[model samples]
Target: MRIRRVGAYALLLDCGEDEPDVPGRVEAWRAELARRRDRGELDAIEIVPAAATVLLDGVPDPAATARSIAGWTPRPAPVRGTAGVVEVPVTYDGADLPAVAEHWGASVPAVVERLAGTEFRVAFCGFAPGFPYLTGLPAALALPRLPTPRARVPAGSVALAGPYAGIYPTASPGGWLLVGRTGLVLFDVAADPPARLTPGTRVRLAPA
Candidate 1:
């Protein structure tokens, strides 16, 4: 854990060498931070988890906060033995599907089959609220972001970038290559848990 001062806010960054043991580390930090915040030991205004780091905003003192976190050991990783695995139905008719297939030296059907064969876990939510960063995309399908970002990608648009896959939680500009679309609502403000794809939750994509 490292702490830095940014203007009026103190940012605490946890590499979580072990806490976020796997791809879903961000969610572990989220739940842990919530517990600390509830105890009033720390005041955390915002919790942002990315591919590699968890940013905690609004620590009164950076030096003291860093000392506290560094001295304390993180708890065990969350157990998902009882967590539900969410399966989403997708139509493999995306504009970039064929291009991606060609890039991988495989047919479109082959690409789809590979994608559906494995299960992925939600690693974190970023880029947009409720937008999940999923892990476990096969190495063969790993691809780069588009050279040109689309002005707007609709909600539930399934996209691939590098070794990760994601579903757009809301309409937003994105550069990931679209592979399919799902009818499932990933983010809904009115729902108890706005983002359906929480960390630790498993996701299996299937043909519509």
Candidate 2:
């Protein structure tokens, strides 16, 4: 793992190239950092994890933190406690269902079975407000982004692209292959946290 010092107050741990297939490792790192801070081993710092990176912001000393992270080995999947998993109800009736099934070489029902059966984790939140870039889709099922971006995708659209499954929190243009949708309010400006899917949260796509 390579640590890139972000200015003077943060360190970005690039776990991308080293562990391309295992994003849960990033979650492990985040959990460890939070554990350190909570136990008074680390100073006040924010542990923000992405697809394959964790950004430690508000670092008291970058070098010290880097050395500390470097000294530890990363753990495997099953990111955290069971309480973190959020069940998401999807309709499994996206317009792209046939296409996705064709790509997977499976029947429509079989595709739905595969999706609903997987346990997913929120690796990061990006692309839009409350939009979660979830991991857990196997590499063999990875698909490329749409050749032409859509002008607008409705809120609660559950989609997939390139080893990631995502939920569109609000209406906006996107390119991911839409396979289903949910009714849950994934984002609301008036909400306490605003975003329903924070990084490190677990997810399951349940057929609604």
Candidate 3:
């Protein structure tokens, strides 16, 4: 890991080339930073994670904080349980489910099974609020976004693009292939954190 300043109050941790397991590494760093923040070791406002880097915001001393994190070894995150897990109940009936199954040479039930069986980790949050880019879809199941994005994808619409699976927190234009729908409210302004699927959270899709 390498740290560089992103201005005066922000620092970015570059974790080298992106890999299948990079999100886990980023989560480890984010958790450690949160611990330090709680202990008064660092003054940070936000710790945002992405595919290959962790952004530290509101840092009082970027250089010193960077040096401290560099010397610290990241610990392994919890592999199971509900510490950071979000269980989303899904209805596996989607407009593109048939097409997706055809693309994978699998039956409809097989597609749902494959998606529900995998464990995903939120790699980042972008494109829309509360919309997490989850990583963990098997390579055999990975596919590209639609050539023509829909003018507005419905809220709670579960979609997949590239190697990521995401839910539409609110109705908006999107290109990801719709695979399912859920009833969970992904974003609630009244909630403490707003976004239900924060970066580093483990996500599971359950048939409802």
* lDDT (Cα, tens digit) per residue for candidate 1, span 94-139: 8899888988898999989987876887877888889888888755
Question: Number of clashes in model 3?
Answer: 0
Model 1: residue 139 alpha-carbon error in angstroms = 5.4
Model 1 TM-score is 0.75
> In model 3, how large is the Cα lDDT of residue 6?
98
Q: Which model is ahead, 1 or 2, in terms of TM-score?
A: 2
Clashes of 1: 0
Runs of candidate 1 with Cα error greater than 4 angstroms are 7-9, 14-45, 60-62, 73-82, 138-140
Span of ten consecutive residues with least summed lDDT in model 3: 15-24
User: Which candidate number has the best lDDT?
Assistant: 3
Give one digit per residue, the lDDT tens place, for model 3 in 24-46.
77878888888888998878899
Stretches off by above 4 angstroms in model 3 are 18-20, 82-84
lDDT scores of the candidates, listed in order: 0.77, 0.86, 0.87
In order of appearance, the predictions have TM-scores of: 0.75, 0.92, 0.92
